[model samples]
Target: MTIQQRKSYLIQVGAFLSQFKSSGIEKRLDLACNDPFFDQMLEQIDMAVHYNGWFTRENVLFSLEEWDKALSEENLEKWLKSYNFQEESKTVGLVMAGNVPLVGFHDFISVLLSGHKVLVKLSSNDKKLLPILANYLVSINPEFSDKIEFTDGRMNNFDAIIATGSNNTARYFEYYFRNKPSIIRKNRNSVAILTGNETQEELKLLAEDIFRYFGLGCRNVSKLYVPQDYNFDSFFNAVLPWAHLMDHAKYANNYDYNKAVYLMSEFKLLDNGFLILKEDPGFGSPIATLFYERYTNKDALLETLQAERENLQCVVSQDLMESEVSYGATQHPKLWEYADNVDTLTFLQNL
Candidate 1:
């Protein structure tokens, strides 16, 4: 199929997804598929949450909505205009991460849109949603059936590789795909820089950056760089909307365990019933906890962040850095905001 045809099919899929929202699903749009297929998708969304405790309904719908916005014809055309897809097609291997729902869908879309086939190795924790969406894509156009494949075992017979995993697993991928053109990603976390002048609305939005997906996504802010004399009262009050997250058993368990450990160690902590704020210099924090460090000056903080750029996915700030992601937008990256700042489409087209 031509690139326009492929993009048209995905636009149809996006139309179907836009009908569903976090509040409820509504059949408002005139979808191309039958009712049974749409019904099955709704069932799969619920089944995905059941299969993975971290995949809450709200989070899954948030992911779907983000894609629905991204798959517009204008967005697709604009994003792909710079790339040349006339080169010979090859099979691109994908090692997907399951930290959040549909975390690897961008790479899947990139490989196919670049006029190449895709062989996906889905993370076991996120095995349900993508295949169902892939089926929906195939239903939109039978030609797509030849473009997608899924494997549970070791992946092979591909031209190049795109892998996302922890630092340790990345090392294995590097050794295994040493001779191939590859983009092997390691663990990276996002952090927010607070200037102590942010309004309550901005602070509330920043809470969304921290608590969304239960702080599981690399884009989720796990740490904060605050002014030396920053107060916690405003920040804690702004996060009150998400206090209900403590109702989740897994989250509550993590909270209790982490709090207990901190208490035993006699560490200074600021707790507001649900989330814990600790003075830590680390980038990656445990679930139900947010690590923070005080910065005396902006220059030193910028230098430190620049030095740690490789270990960071993105920086969340107002005007601190040139590439700062807005307070609430870290999780809702656009189609071209490739993970690890590695352009998947360029890689695939070159290969």
Candidate 2:
């Protein structure tokens, strides 16, 4: 299929996705293949929730809503304008990550849009959603039927590979796909730099960045870099709205267990019933807790952040650095905001 054909098919999928919202699913009669695929898509989302404890209905719908915005005709055109597509197609292997809903959809689409076929190995945590979406795309055009394939076991017979996993698994990917063109992603955490001058509104928005998806996605801010003598009163108060998260059984269990361990270890902690703030230098934090470090010198902190860039997926801040993600905006990344700062489309185009 031509690039234009691929783009058109994807835009239709985006329109279909736009119908599913957090409030409820609204079936639009005008949508193509609405009768057959619309209800099936909804059932798949429900199945996803039953299959994975982390795949809450609200979170899954939020992911779909974000993609709906991303695949709009304008956004798609603007994002793809900078890339040149190749005429020949190759088979691209995808080992998807299931930390969050539809986490690997970007790579899936990138391969297709670059005029390549995709062989997918779905993460068990997120197996249902993508295949149904792939089917929806195929329903849009029968030509897409030959381009998509999913394997539950080993992934092979592909020209290139795109895999996401922990740092340990990344090493294995590097060695295994050594001779092939690939993009191998590793563990990354997002952090926020607090200057002690943020508005209440901004701090509240920052709470969204920290707690959304139960702080499971890489884009979720798990750590904070605060100025020396920074106070926690305002920050804690601003994030009070998310206290409802404590009602989630899984999250509550984690909070209880971590709180017990912290108390037993006699570590200093600032707790507000639902969330805990601990003074730590680490970027990744446990569930129900956030790590923070104090910096007295701005220049020193900048140097440290620059040095540890590979360990970070995003730096949430306000006017602190170039390319820093704004408060609460990390999760709603644009289509071109490639993960690990690696350009997937560029990788596919070259392949």
Candidate 3:
């Protein structure tokens, strides 16, 4: 299919997703053979929660809505406008991350949109959702069936690669795909920089950055850099919306386990009955716990963050650092907001 045809088919898929939400599902499309697909996809969404405890209906719908917003005609056209795709197509191997729902979707979309065939290695934790969506896309345009392939074992027969994994797994990827052009992403965590003057509203938004996706996404704020002597009363209060998360059996178990470890280790922790905030300089924090460090000087903190840029996926703040994501917007990345700041479209075009 041509680029315009690909874009149009994606837009139709987005429209189908827009019809469903956490509140209810609706039949808003008049396409041929859509009823069973819609009903089954909704069933898959419900089944996804059982497959992975973190994949709640609310979180799944949030991911769907975000993609629905992203796959618009305008967004797709604008994002692809800068790339030239006249070169021969290649098979692009993708090793996806399953930390969050449909986490590797952008790369999937990127490979297909660049006119290359994609061979995807799905994360076991996120097995169901993307395949269902891929089925929808194939239904929209049968050509995609030829362009996309899912593999359960080792991935091969690709000209280039895009792999996301932990720091340890990335080493294996680098050695295995050493001869090929590749984008291998390692562990990276997001942080929030908080000044003493942040309003309650902004702090509440920041809470979303921390609690969304049960803090599994790379964009989820895992650490906080706050002014020395900063009071956390308002910060604790702002996170009330996510208090319901503590009710989840898995999250509650994590909270209990982490809190017990902290107490037994004699580490100081601030708790709000649901979430734990501990002072730590590390980038990655455990689930249900947020690490924070006190910063005495803003300039020094900026320098430190800049020096540790490789370990960071995003910085959530209000102009605290250059190009920092606004509070509460970490998860709502734009079409061009490439993961690890690596331009996937350009990578595919070059391949």
Write the residue-wise lDDT of candidate 3 on 6-25 in tens digits. 88888887888887776777
TM-score for each of the candidates = 0.98, 0.98, 0.98
Model 1, runs deviating above 4 Å: none
Score candidate 2 by lDDT.
0.92
Location of the lowest summed lDDT over 10 successive residues in candidate 1? 28-37
Clash tally for model 1: 0
Off by over 4 Å in 3: none
**Candidate 2 displacement at residue 335 in angstroms:** 0.5
Over 1-351, each residue of candidate 2 has an lDDT whose tens digit, in order, gives 778889999999899999999988999989888787888878877876688887888899999999999999999999999988965568999999998999999999998899999999989888888988899988889988899999998877899999999999999999999989999999999999999999999999999999999999999999999989999899999999999998888899999999999999999999999998889889999999999999999879988999999999999998879979999898899999999899999899888
Minimum summed lDDT over a 10-residue window in model 3 is located at 24-33
Which candidate number has the best lDDT? 2
- Top candidate on TM-score is 2
Candidate 2 least-lDDT 10 residues = 40-49
| Per-residue lDDT over 157-247 for candidate 1, one digit per residue giving the tens place of the 0 to 100 score | 9999999999999999999999999999999999999999999999999999999999999999999999999998999989999999999
Candidate 1 local Cα displacement, residue 84, angstroms: 1.4
